[model samples]
Target: MSTTDVLVVGAGPAGLACAATVLEHSDLSVVVLDAGHGPGGQYWRQPAPASGPGALDGAELADLHHDRGTFVELVRRVEQGRAEGRLEIRSEQHVWSVVPDGERYAAHTVDRSGGPGREAGSTTRARAVLVATGAYDRALPFPGWDLPGVMTVGGLQALLKAGGVRAGQRVAIGGTGPFLLPVAAGLARRGSTIVGVYEANRPGGWLREGRAVVRNPAKLGEGAGYAATMLRHRVPVRTGRMIVSAHGTDRVEAVTVARLDRAGHPVPGSEQRVAVDAVGVGWGFTPQLDLAVTLGVDLTTDLAGTPVVGVDDLQRTSRPRVYAAGEVCGVGGAALAVAEGRLAAAGIVADLSAHGMPGASVARDRREVARLRAFADAILRAHPVPAGWADRLEDDTILCRCEEVRCATVRSAIDELGATDARQVKQLTRTGMGWCQGRVCGYAAALLSSGRPGPAVERLISAPVPLGALAAQPTSEPHVE
Candidate 1:
């Protein structure tokens, strides 16, 4: 197995920033592992490589991304580090587990570079580990949500940003949060006929968070740009409305939109049917903490009741030699993620080297993180998941699509089977025992049984691994740095 001084577990904004910082500030050798085919993670997803036909170049893809200058600079710095032989980035490498190996850690990975049937397993040992696994879309269940052509807003944006492919000719977007605006604007720019943008929360809620808005003027400018795009495309945004059901024989053809009352319930006789070929919905995001959980790092909940890795001002976790940044710490935006990543690298440099990070620099980054995170908290408070979302689910609504578990089954598990939490419900009704291993349905299951999101169930294996790859793993001890 190979060894390095620092191993970063993502290649997104946070991971790229961390690796670049470590190389610039200290003599530490850094290695980055990511599951994506290239860098930028989900926020700055890139197009296919230029080697392929019809591939979009950097100039062509820049319009699809926000803060392109920052991404470009980070990528250039990372490339320079790679050229200098101080950093190595292994793309398409899925790090499934990280276990303690003496004073260091061993990260097991399944390489998907060769695609199907050629998967290989490998291990890397490092003295320090940083996890920047990022977050995934938070989806809520509605009637016909499982139907084809219905997906999360993030998935829709991924298609447009990664390949410039519009998902459908006519689309209906629904959710709570400002995220809906950008997705709708992007799709509309790509020639999709946006039927309507349904937002469950009113924009006036932002008036209450005046201090946060003043602290982050760039956010207001960004919001205004998206508003201009929507106005240019004539995309109608309806406030205090939600899509309660999608209807179709085979795929999504139409959606039933309902006005929400103050209690977040559907207003009687206020439903309208909107025709659309596709529907995109999102509540918010859930921090991806699988790797952090496996590392046994201290955990805490965020404003949305989602579990996040606990970290100090310098981004050091409770576990020694382990650090966490970006969405794994909390669901802040990319700017906050970059700041946290640089801070984590600074912490690593101070711990590994004789001279520590400059007091002024560290304090500056800490203040930046606090400002951006405050804006994030304001966003969460403004666009919270509707209190009565589960009240809209029908008895036949599927909770876990992989296991075919329905709403009625979950209720039965809670009422008749003495299941008080998501864990017990998983055991009694098999709600979270499907192929996804609770990634998709865990939130809904937890909220159904308990009033809040529950702790994630840790697994030895984070992702599905080929049996042959597992069989081929080396039994020898990893070389410690």
Candidate 2:
């Protein structure tokens, strides 16, 4: 087993920033393990490597990302730290569990970098552990949502960013929040015909949070740029509208768009049929808390009522020597994540080093986090999940695609089986006892039964592992710092 002064569980903006800060502020050794093949996480995901070396260049993928400069700088610092032997990064390593070992923590990981003679499972013990696992796309169910061409907006973005592939020639983007804008704009730029951009919430709600809007001028500029792109591509940006249902035989060939009432229900007379080969939908994000829950960290709800890891201003979790940053704290953007990460690193430095982080730097990062988080709250308020979303579910609509649990089964569990929460529903109807372990269907299930998002389900294994890997785990105790 390997040991380190600090172990970061992600290489996203938050993890990268935290590693860089720790290296610059202290002499401690750091190791970063990420499931991604490289750094940048989902926000700045790079394209897959070309068949030959130097075939794909940064210039080719530049337009696919936002805030490239920040990603570049963080990567540079991480590379420098690795070169000087102050840091190590294990890419394509999925850390499944973290357990308390005396005064330290032991992280169990499975190597996912498929190749010849790869170690299946291993453990690394660290003095301090920081989880920046980030969030994933939260999708709600509707008729034909399980169709072949239906996908989350994040998935569509991933396809374009990671593989330079457009989801379809004709794409209809539907969702709430500012995310749809960028996805629509990117696909439009990539030579896809955007049928329309359907947003369930009206942007006028931002007027209520005028102070936050003024505080983040950069966000406004970003929005303005996307607006320009939409106008340039002639992509229709319709507010107070949502895609109620997708329609097709074997794949999605059209969608039903409906204007939403004040209560977020669809207006019966306002439905319109739009033709599209691909449909992308989203309802904000759910913070990834699998490892955090396993570590027994405190949990709380964010502004959107999504469960997130609870942390102090310095990003310290309830568990001693444990910290969490980025979307795990809340579903803010990358800038806020970076601030929180740097702050978490500062907390670690203060706790572990003889010389703690400078007061001025800590204070500055705190202020930045506060400002960015406020803007994030504003965004959440502006784009809440439509209250009547579940009301539109048909009896045959698939709720859990993995197990083919339909809306009727879920409703039966709730109304007839005395299931008041997702857990009870799962026990009664097998709603979440599938391969995904409720990651995709948990949010919708909770909302349907309990009227709120469910708590993160605790699991010893965060991701699926090969049985051979489990058998190959070493019996020796991991060395502690």
User: Roughly what TM-score does model 1 have, to 2 decimal places?
Assistant: 0.97
TM-score of every model?
0.97, 0.97
lDDT of 2 by residue, 5-66 (tens): 99999999999999999999999999999998689899988765456854665558778889
* Candidate 1 regions with alpha-carbon error over 4 angstroms: 50-52, 477-481
In order, the Cα lDDT scores of the candidates are 0.90, 0.91
What TM-score should be assigned to candidate 2?
0.97
Each model's number of backbone clashes?
0, 0
RMSD of 1: 1.8
Per-residue lDDT tens digits for candidate 1, residues 325-387, read 999998888999999999999999999877787888889999999999999999989998788
Give every collision pair in model 1. Answer: none
Model 1's lDDT to the true fold? 0.90
